[model samples]
Target chain A: MTAPAGQRGRGRPRDPRTDQAILAAALELFTEHGHAGTSIEQIARRAGVGKLTVYRRWGSKDELIAAAVESARGEIPSPGIGDLDGMSYAQISQVIAEALPGSARTLAEPGYRAMLAQVFGSSVTHPGLMAAFWNDHILPRRRTAHLALSRAVDEGVLPPETDIEALIDMTVGAVVYRLLRPEPPDADELLAYLRSVYEQAGMIPRR
Target chain B: MTAPAGQRGRGRPRDPRTDQAILAAALELFTEHGHAGTSIEQIARRAGVGKLTVYRRWGSKDELIAAAVESARGEIPSPGIGDLDGMSYAQISQVIAEALPGSARTLAEPGYRAMLAQVFGSSVTHPGLMAAFWNDHILPRRRTAHLALSRAVDEGVLPPETDIEALIDMTVGAVVYRLLRPEPPDADELLAYLRSVYEQAGMIPRR
Candidate 1:
């Protein structure tokens, strides 16, 4: 096997800065115009990179779309699983309020919402891409949250028999639904609702 | 002003059966192919009627889409507000299971799911159509459920302070989230989850 092109001292060296530009461009175009509306040429032009550069880096439009989505996912902050062990209820709520609403704000953007709609809409026709998205992006994040929740249960912060997976699903799912609606709930309103839900669940005592 | 064609009836009379055929065809095509993919011509052809018939009845594709979605909405059974008073926990649980899972099953269909995604995805670009959909379809259904839930609160089946709107939003949103996923939860599983959530919320007591 040949050394990867970036490692070889042949031709021009691959610039990390150019990769960031391309990824950002890809994400913007994909979100704004959707999969069918976006083109690799448009992404290249937006990034001020050669068409060959994008192709060489991503292989195909599908791969580029996946990369852009993955990049977006990375930008969102998630709670540290390690922090769950010693965290108090207020601290956990703070983590959720910060992490979830920030992501909701991102999701509420017209372009980003369009991108998600495109992916979900096309999943029936493109099962492989959907599977990759689930395995690589959705599942890992879910597992992280799940593990943290399980720890909360073990520590008696949540009841022993609480269905952590369903709890996570319901909480996240409600936020997503609000984001997808024509009129999303205000961030403060959503935070308050979540606080009430957690309090009612006995995850935290009512204030 | 000239009398409408249906009433003028110079040559042929308007048949009610033909109206049903057009409505059914519109719903099918709109669900399967989405708003942009479907056309009046295609709908007419599918219904074995002339294109003029569709235009005469619905005026435009947007109106036709609204009519089709409205028709589908009418077909889904909702709990009457009258039924909520004095309903027992087990009775309420049964009502929720039947009403929710049935709607979920319909929403889970690839065709129906595509229709919803198309409407939601295009909301940014086509606010008029989206507004009409929300006004004519979403709002009415929500109102029905809201009235029923308000009765539940009044009857002491649910807490006096229950946030009926938020409760409705979270419950429906969770189901919508599950239905929209590539691998939706099983029907029975979702029903059980809903039951548990209701029980935990004190809308119903544990079995």
Candidate 2:
């Protein structure tokens, strides 16, 4: 239970900022050093907070790391599945175009690449991390992509029998494959590649 | 620099069997516990050999892991670019069809998935490992895929303006994506999905 302002101990006051700082530090540490490499003490040290402060919020390291990764959802783009519900093909394309610059920038970052690698690597051994990632980060984007594909089918751009899941896998997988390469693409290259994949899939019209 | 068998000490003779054992152990350790978690001592212990045996063969952990990863080149399927050269589109498709079963089986294995995750995760942090994997494993396969795509262009299966690299990325990426999912597809499903992506890409004729 969170103590009222008056009932708090003599420790530094806890606020939304403290939670943000702890989560950010956790994400950075987890990205740099994998799940096993990072520890709660390290997170607190990096966050300039007491170990108890982190412990107070999260019951375990997995929980903390899960929260840290979930925090990254805002940094990456999602399809805005609900908003896209009734959008036309052109409208969907516009949303994707506007989002590409930011998505490309984030995906191109070395830190983000490492973070994704860590997450994927942990899937078998550390199921909790992968579960959190899948639920929060992956599912929404996947849903959005599915909706867009459905729209494409309805609009007669893709044949009704088009394997939408396969298309999503290819589009997402291609981006990941590019990122994991020894020489990953830069933002501009990544943007061009994303546009090309979407255009090829008929999700967006070619220029 | 080899001591003749007659000149060898009481220790076990350095032989191909020993090398295989060490490499197998190194790969197993690296897959189970990532690059950072594995150690030479553990590898030796796992292989039932002396620590010096591993050191005598590989100068460092990175070299050992590199060799270990390189040793796996035979396990995964790659396009035989030379064989595919000048072959008809139907011939190319036959080669792919024959290869897909083995590829699907390997890709569906949990151990293979974990190994891939480790290799990809280490790309930025451990370039040496990725370099060896690329040179020994990835490069040949990529070359084969490229040749196949070029053949598709020649056969008029794909448009002349087709982005072969993008198509290749999607196919490989889709397989990898499927493997890393929480509920990864079984061999049969993986085979079907692979066929779908290839068929969609015009790399192989749809049945």
Winning model by lDDT: 2
Off by over 4 Å in 1: A1-13, A41-52, A88-90, A98-105, A127-161, A185-207, B1-14, B86-90, B127-162, B185-207
lDDT of 2: 0.82
lDDT of each: 0.64, 0.82
Candidate 1, overall lDDT? 0.64
Model 2 lDDT per residue over A27-73, tens place: 99999888989998999999999887887777678999999989987
Q: Write the per-residue lDDT of candidate 2 for residues B4-92, one digit (tens) a residue.
A: 23343435466999999999999999999999999989999999998777777877789899999888768878677788888887888
Fnat (0 to 1) per candidate: 0.22, 0.57
Q: Write the per-residue lDDT of candidate 1 for residues A56-131, one digit (tens) a residue.
A: 6766778777777777666556666576656655566556555656655565556666666556544554444455
Each prediction's RMSD over C-alphas, in Å, is 5.6, 5.0
> What is the total number of backbone clashes in candidate 1?
0
